[model samples]
Target chain A: MADAEAKERRILVAVDEGEESMYALSWCLKNLICESSKDTLILLYVKPPRVVYTALDGTGYMFSSDIITTMEKYSNDVAGCVIEKAKTLCRDLQNVKVETKVEHGDPRDVICEMTGKLGADMLVMGSHGYGLIKRAFLGSVSNHCAQNASCPVLIVKRPKSTAGSN
Target chain B: MADAEAKERRILVAVDEGEESMYALSWCLKNLICESSKDTLILLYVKPPRVVYTALDGTGYMFSSDIITTMEKYSNDVAGCVIEKAKTLCRDLQNVKVETKVEHGDPRDVICEMTGKLGADMLVMGSHGYGLIKRAFLGSVSNHCAQNASCPVLIVKRPKSTAGSN
Candidate 1:
């Protein structure tokens, strides 16, 4: 745990296995000042639930094991994409310990929860690489974390070349 | 120039005409600890090229007149959104002015470049909302600003639940 404590001031990227997110992750790894000793590049990806019915129903029997397994598979697929991107981001870095994690639930909550749990000093999120609406783009997850988190939060916007892709 | 110098530390929100971003802009007006006495919220939206064409000789050109018109409409829409959001976000708060800007070209470069030009103390952006990815949602713009800005960048991520949405 103390070893984890040592890397507290490092960068933690919330990735979702996309080229734009990867570009942001790469940008962080390349530009951050982490060479003093060593830092952490914690790559996090979450598996959001496709169906809320089972959760709403609140009964274990409502969902079958097959569905859970399929969800887990989907989670792995997403995580695999994130991990691949992270590896590319870390390809040139030295003295950085890269750790990967895949979780099942809400990404904002999971990421915010992991901030302290992972001993992160600050959080970095890319701006509009994802094609959500401008309103939803800034309001959803980023808004929640900004309002609630105790630590500093970074809300990034991707370039027009990227955001303009629509 | 002196007026611009005195205007440093304004809160710059890259407006993209959305409800979520509007919520974020409003939240910044009310909750920011950076002091409303000397602060203003600068809402900016970058308009992308409407048409991209490769000339016969391989020159890429983006035609403008129509794009400019659309950009005006976009700026008006988001400016209205910011003003409306501010009425409540600030309510009866004192000493803060809310301003909006319409721009053409890259959003990331504009934010970073403006940060330099405005001598901004901080830049804020939303994390994830209506972006392309379902689970991983930090926009690339949020990421780039986090890494490249001279000043601090705040990336806001919101919660998905109705109870947590506010």
Candidate 2:
């Protein structure tokens, strides 16, 4: 069903194709309500920096052409997966609007920036995403987003043992 | 290491024996530094409900009791383990204050209660702590706390795949 109220309330779900994130997305679908209207679900995924730099005689070297191409391809593939999953979930919800967004750069910075532009009220996200290994080496997107986001964030916790359960 | 400048700052960590909880505790130890002579780490653990019930089978003869145990033995064990871990970690931090407390109730409620009663400025915790099976049955503590907390909360995101990687 289409209506004016359905277009308003916003619930942003940061997806990285992880169990916790999916659980959070599911939770949002089940709990969020706008008094008399349905809420909007936005699936957001931020692609990590693909430009790799090497130390060429102590000076930073530009990313190789092949690496850059591969990075773009990989980012597109991951983003596509997020959109697909969100679409499947949206099919089940009644009148709620579900949209997808993808961006590049720091996950926290991008989310904070987006929130400023889009007055979203709640951030639903899983604590661990597909980039867990990379995050452990550098940092975690969930941590940064929770710390920096202006709005309240729902961090769905998934236990290691339950990784494959969901 | 122990002087007048190390007595004012206090760090409160909600310990639950979940590795993710420890991650938040570690982050607090790394950050939330005190400029003066006071540094205290308070490890708080809230024990959730644990009771046993016995009932009679249908038909004519089997009778059983519906009495719940006074306390949950497993919960106590988890709290004890978390406290021990915190104590061991606190040994190396210089000019820091460390303590442990375990209470019974909902973790989010207990945390808020403790913070209010203690007048804590900041809170650090892992994003999720419920084990796989329990999480499926109940829910994650961090998500609940984020929605209901009155003060600032730092929810540390655990990596999805922290195995084999450093």
How well does candidate 1 match the true structure in TM-score terms? 0.46
Query: For candidate 1 chain A, which ten residues in a row score worst on lDDT?
Result: A129-138
Tens-digit lDDT string for candidate 1 (A11-72)? 67777644556656754553342343356677877666445425544555666788778766
lDDT of 1 at A10: 53
What's the TM-score, to 2 decimals, of chain B in model 1? 0.62
Error of 2 at B26 (Å): 31
lDDT for A13 in candidate 2 is 79
lDDT of each: 0.56, 0.61
Q: What is the C-alpha RMSD of each candidate to the true structure, in Å?
A: 14.7, 18.8
Question: Tens digit of lDDT per residue, candidate 2, span A18-91?
Answer: 65667666645543432335566788887775532232123556767896787689778978987788677657
Docking class of 2: incorrect
Model 2 spans > 4 angstroms off: A1-8, A33-36, A51-63, A159-161, B1-166
lDDT of 2 at A26: 60
| Per-residue lDDT of candidate 2, residues B67-115 (tens digit) | 2332355557777887898778667656555677888866667886786
